[model samples]
Target chain A: MKFTRRDFTAGLAVGITAPYVIGSARAQGATIKLGMCAPVTGPAAESGGYAVKGARIALEAVNKAGGILGKQAELIVEDDQTTNPGIVLAFSKLAAESDIVAFLGSIRSTQVHAMAPDVLKLGKPVMIGGTDPNLTHMGNQWLFRFRPNDSYSGRVIADYGFNTLGKKKWAVLHSTDAFGTAGGKALGAALEKLGSPAILDQGYANQSQDFTPVVLAIKQSGADILGSYFTYENDIGIFARQLRQLGVNIPWVGSPSITNITALKLAGPALYGTFGVADYAEESSEASKAFGKAYRDVVKVAPDNQSSWPYDAINVLAAAINKAGSTEPAKIREAILATRKFPGAEGEYNFDQNGDGLHGYNIVKNEKGTIVFDKHIEFTD
Target chain B: MNNPQFLLPNAVMDLVLQLLFTGIGIGAVYALVALGFVLIFRATNVVNFAQGEFSMVAAYLMVVFAVDLGWPYWLSFLLSLAGMALLGAIFNLGVYYPLRHRSFLPVIIATIGASILLANSVLAIYGPQPQVLEGWFETPGIQLGPVYLDSQYLLIIAVTIVMVAFNYWFFEHTMLGKKLQATSQDKEMASLLGISVSTMIMITFIYSAVLGGLAGILVAPVLFVSIQMGSTIALKAFAATIIGGFGDVAGAIIGGLALGIIETFGAAYISVPYKDGFAFLVLVLFLVFRPQGIFGERVAEKA
Candidate 1:
């Protein structure tokens, strides 16, 4: 307990190593590193890559606009491997880097949930595409959502499917993952609000290759309409095919994954008439149209929610950085919380204290393998 | 529930039958993959976890050769199978042979490593997006009474039968078959009797890889070709292999078909959400009660 020169030298050695341990964190450099955690190589790679592309486009655009705080903004990307542990590791690696001021989180709610604690501990802002409502409301100040949470999308999907389409007797199908379960629960609640309960509520695992039984169950349940929140595009594609094969011609409304180009292409004619709520559509708004056209010029495909949110996320983040005039976390966080009337590929954006921006969902229909935007629904609270 | 009257003029019945047909088609693909798993496991006692990746690689190769290079489907198909066989041989020589005498766990793990490497390599080369294979074989579904079946499904069933028959004949009557069987039964004894155990292992891998390639090529028309396709089918086939008795050839074939039927029926009658779970649940039950599998031979522990 006594102070001595030996102890003082040892304490100084610990202090020096502590700063070294936090690699890239507070590095004496001008470059502002924005960490991007995405699924670059797994089942969700198609969508995740698009998100990364959008983020990169935003990064390039921001750097062109004189960079953030007059310092070059660099995106430090890490593949999340599409698993919880992988995401945690990627986040930790990024968090350890002192120069990384903010991060772009994954589309998987589970991954975001796993990465949230680390993001909070690191005290860095993370813009996320995951729509799980609890992600922002879980007392995590650093977590920012670029897309409207499922709680908003679910009500929109139910309202559109029942009131707009004037169909009742719903069949709700969802993947049994965190996103799907929560989306399904939200949709079911929305349906109940309209005095119509789901005749058949089902949950399938991600990456399922067959959806015959699910389709058959829907057919037998006497449901005239269907709603789903599939976790994987492939599963949604297969399910769409099986549903058509089973002659279930009812109006189908689903969550964002259903509107993915991959699903549309794989399912082909089977998904032609399906409707869903998405964060990004090729034809959402004038701003969205420009973003979509630009994305098509680069990626040679129409933009979906996966591609659009990250585009908006980057633009919003860049705007925040520019407005704050600093790469410091508190300044950027304040600017992000003050986001208002900023046009994005998704829609006009505003960020709450919880970091969720753009409180609207784009209703889209699969019009012969193309996502045709129908309408947009904005929400409060 | 068994009343025939319940079946007539009911859209629900039609839906069930349609699902059954669809499940059968998908299940046929699973059976084909499972057959490959059995072939390699039986001859080499090495569970090729990368069997699915073999199929994926072959399918992608076919896409590259046939679709991209504008070769005929038949030509590309044959070349893809040959390419997979060659890959199998290379894998056996490079990875399996060196680790042949090692524990089964190491061999399994190695296959997993190989699977990851192959999938990632394909991703790196082809990029992550799914590609549709172009060919004349991709015709629209043919109506069959109340239900419809894609021509690709029929082609898959026919090809699977032909391959299964060919494998049966080769294993039962061929000299190479006898040598392989001899090696599988007793590798050291077969080596003493002048049969090359390594060669037999290589041949077995080639055979299985070809089967996997054929599955990929055939199923690609329905599912389209993607790197992740192999892993999904591989898991189902693994379950199928366990159900049929790990090393039982007939069990693998029958077990695959039975699995397809069970999954289809279970999905229709039980629950659609947990359709894949049915196979895994059955696998766990089988492991608990009949670890050797439905048709697997019982082996004594060496220790």
Candidate 2:
């Protein structure tokens, strides 16, 4: 084929751009890309580091076990900075990359809520640890939760407090954030159903320097028991110290944060007798114990819900991807939804219609600064 | 909500006293931080947005020495203050000196940039975990006739009072303090009158940083030493400074205490979730009605 001047110019143009286009395509195909949004630098940065470590561990294990879809999986993390706007920007940055078929979202419900719209727009399955009941039920099909929602935690907290502890009057204290509000509401609903509604339901802003008014309110309420859903560990630490200092020593049952390593360290003796609805109790199950040992060996720290959920999310997502034999968003969604009796570090995963994987919480006590698992409460209905 | 019967005469009085004590405790913290803001603003004619970061860096320094190295609390406290003084000197040189000839806006922006840099640098070196710093007192608190007085809070209030007296004495009596005051009042005139204007500014920065660091070290046990702790307190302290009169020392103290009391009472009587809202609402009201602040004087014409 004899080339004219015009054809020669066209061939030269193709020669220059062809290698660039092909190299980009090859890079994309080399690995199974997974995106993650975490709080690399913010109030939740400590937990975010744990989350990233958990995901990395799971990724290593997945690669060792033939990887996801017969290809080595890679995780690309973007710092959510532990803020709504920060998560939105982080999610958008990850979403802009079309090769990332699935993503790991934040454990904080508010951050997850901030990125929910973007996740829907992308139409890809995103694993999350956020436990807001509304997160799964808010018509966001792409979002799958690895942890039990607040509805179950609320029930478990209320059940353990009212029946086992034999406490009647209750004062429910929670942060005013999305997670805290929903958890508080769910706990209130559960108590009402149990015919022992809380006498004082109080909500306080996050990052509060003092909890005097809150402690005072709880004191005056004359409640025999206290139920709380604190968002940040620092807030919990402050509130717990003040609560005990103010001479109000009612039986306290808190959300998962109460059992967090940070909270335990910060509150110290103040949280000694309190109970928490933990999603990741190391002694709760064999899988949990295994994860705990592995985490302790690798991370050199006790694993909490902050790390456990991400570990479960990564493992579950890999398993679902292998089961589907495809990375298509709908196929992954179906496979994740079909996950049943899947043992995870959090609990036994049985995905419901709303994409909620775990349907229960473990009641653990802060026994002398050590989190001791008391009982596991699973719900079926 | 409190029941009407629960609000008996004794109960009401007890509640008010408790609220007042707690309010003053938290207010003292804001006052300390606000005092830092006031001193720097007075000296440089620029708002040091990094005032909060100064607190944060000092707290981290305390964590490194006291918690990580297991040093004595008293020694760690002194070392942290020393580190803050050095940081203040460097910050003056790096962030303020080059931009000193420029307008106030550049200096203010530089301080903000420095704050971000300081926060991220700490995050990079120490990681993101919040460290627990034990308070100085063995007893957590004491029950004083139906009201609880936290030991740390009592210390904070006492220190704040002492600092106020110290500041008054230092500024009004000492030759160096008079020189610093003169430089702040009229840089050109003070420079002509044989005062080292730059030296006075540097000293002001050092003093402000130490003050900020002191507040952080004091409040670390209560708030926990996290990256966000400084910013959180600083925001409230900034509002306190403005409400107290932007450049007034006494105003900062009063404004901070007033804000602390108002928010505590507001949360108690009105809404807990709107606790921060109450502080900002008061700030907005002050900004609208009394922009010059309670103690600030309005200048009729620019120099």
- In terms of lDDT, the best-performing candidate is 2
Best by TM-score: 2
| Model 1 clashes, total count | 7
Model 2: pairs clashing at backbone N, Cα or C within 3 Å: none
Model 2 error, position B224 (Å): 1.2
lDDT tens digits by residue: candidate 1, B143-167: 7776777677777777778877987
lDDT of 1 by residue, A90-155 (tens): 888888877678899988898898888888888888989888889998999988888888889889
Once superposed on the true structure, which residue ranges of model 1 sit more than 4 Å away at CA?
A1-27, B1-23, B101-106, B134-139, B192-194, B301-303
The positional error of residue A121 in candidate 2, measured at the CA in angstroms, is: 1.2
Pick out the ten consecutive residues of candidate 2 chain A with the lowest summed lDDT.
A22-31
Q: If you superpose only chain B onto the true chain B, what TM-score does each candidate give?
A: 0.92, 0.97
Say which candidate scores most in DockQ: 2
